[model samples]
Target: MKKNQNFRFEKKNRTKLKIKIFSLQIMEFVTHCENSESSTTSSIIPEMETSSQIVELALSVERADTAALLGADESNIDTLEKKRLEEIRQQQISQAKLMAERRQKKAAMGMEERQNWEQEIERYRIENEEVEERQRRLDIDETMEEFYPKLCEWVGLSNYEVLYNSLEDGTNASDLNKKICGEKNVMFIIITKTGYAFGCFCHKKIPYPKKSYIYSMYDKKYFTFSLRNPSCSEPIYFKQKHKGKSICIWPNDEKNFIFTTKRFIKIKNPNGPHGTRSFFHGKFSLKYKSKDHQKREHTFFTQTTAFDVHRLVVLHWF
Candidate 1:
């Protein structure tokens, strides 16, 4: 009986000791869980604040773009735009305050960094000035381009050539030929031995007759005109109702009658638009003349006062 009672007491004490140890373990687990959850919550709070800051920054940038272009009076803006501008102005004021704080911080910086910042600002200013100058020149060029065609049309010039150059007698026939080879419809002004002056507008090349006199030939589309002077504004051209493709009436004695050699034939203007090599812009007059004997040889002559204006250009009808 004494052994049985001792065994039961010892078993009861073991059970009580296990229960106390289990209770301690459960309390420690609960404390550990609380600390882990607190740390996770603290980490999530900073991320949420960062996301909200990014959203605010994006919205501010969006407002700035619209506000920059809406620098006019708020009274002129509609209600929606007015509201947007008001918001932008507030954002700008805040930004200005931040800039003021930054300026204070910059003032506390070293002299080297402050000098570098000033140099950066100067570089940006120079770049802006250069951009403005380039844009000004481009605008001037565009204005001039628009003005030229209008000026030409206002003067009643249907794609007229203005020659400022003068050529005289003794100009090489070969040189003249080289210049006129690719040329089209042309105008020629001449002074006769009797001091009479006449000009012709024809196709192909007009003969630069020096010894040979220049007279009219049969051209279906030739236009003859008399000029008091070689001024473009002073032209007196013959109308089509005058003759209308008649044969030369003047006797072909020594007068340089318009005819063709075996090499070249004169005719009316060819069919096409004019060339755009130059818009001759200046004073024009007769310079020199060559002999008609060289007409077949050099396409020019050297003896007559063939009032040579500047080289002919392709005529475009406006």
Candidate 2:
């Protein structure tokens, strides 16, 4: 019984030791397996991370290419816009040049027109002056023809005889009357001392009531006379000296006479009816008396009643 009990105790002790050993081996094996698995997972994680990075780099490259293409398109658009703007500027410059040329042409045309108008006006002015001159000459010729016959009838003589006698005697009478009647122009007249036996000629008309005088005569006297045509007078008488010795008195018309004497004398009635008469007094005298036994005082008388007593006295020494 005692041997059996000791043997049972030993067997129980062995069984416990075996159990502990087996547990320890199982733990070690589990630990070793866990470590191996952990290392392998770490390596696999690194490979996966590297693959993801490669994918990311590829995506970045694609995005970069797309951006470059877009930038190229933008640059092209900017170039096109610049070209268009330059074209517009060129068009504007062309239009400005066209306008400048047009204005210059218009100004040149206006200057040409103004010059033509001035030339036309000058031509018209010269034409008008020539026409006026022609008309004046025609009128003068017509007037001379109409009055020539009337002057001859009024003077009670033929035209040829009046012209011939005037030239021969150096007289201005026929010429003066012709001028007054518009037959000729009368410049001046030669008158005797008595205002009669005078001569005149002219190519123009003379104003009426013309009178003139001679200064010194053969009788030492000044003689003045006047020729006048009154409104109601028929027979004209020639009047003589105011206060002097007179000789060879000749009657010109009513209130007109001439005297030959040795000295100049002033007339009392110097003015005429029309205030158009002229009086001329000469500077020298004529000697007409005999030497010894010559009568120094003599008076000549006219039968005509139309003479003015105060202004027409003729005195001479015989």
Q: Could you tell me which 10 consecutive residues in candidate 2 have the lowest summed lDDT? A: 294-303
Tens digit of per-residue lDDT, candidate 1, span 182-292 = 343544443322222334455433434344434344444454444333232233444232333322122123222222221112211111133211111111111112222
lDDT of 2 by residue, 1-318 (tens): 999999999977865554455345445656756877554333232232356644654465568779999999998997899999999989999998899888888888887888888888888888887766434322322322433354343333333312222223322332223323322222122222222212122222222333443222222122221222122222222223333333222223423322223232222122334332333233211322322221111111121212231122111111
Q: What's the distance in Å from true for residue 111, model 2?
A: 1.5
Local distance difference test scores for all models: 0.39, 0.36
Q: Candidate 1 — worst ten consecutive residues by lDDT sum? A: 279-288
* Global CA lDDT computed for model 2: 0.36
- Model 1 regions lying over 4 Å from their true place: 1-157, 162-170, 191-197, 204-218, 229-235, 239-318
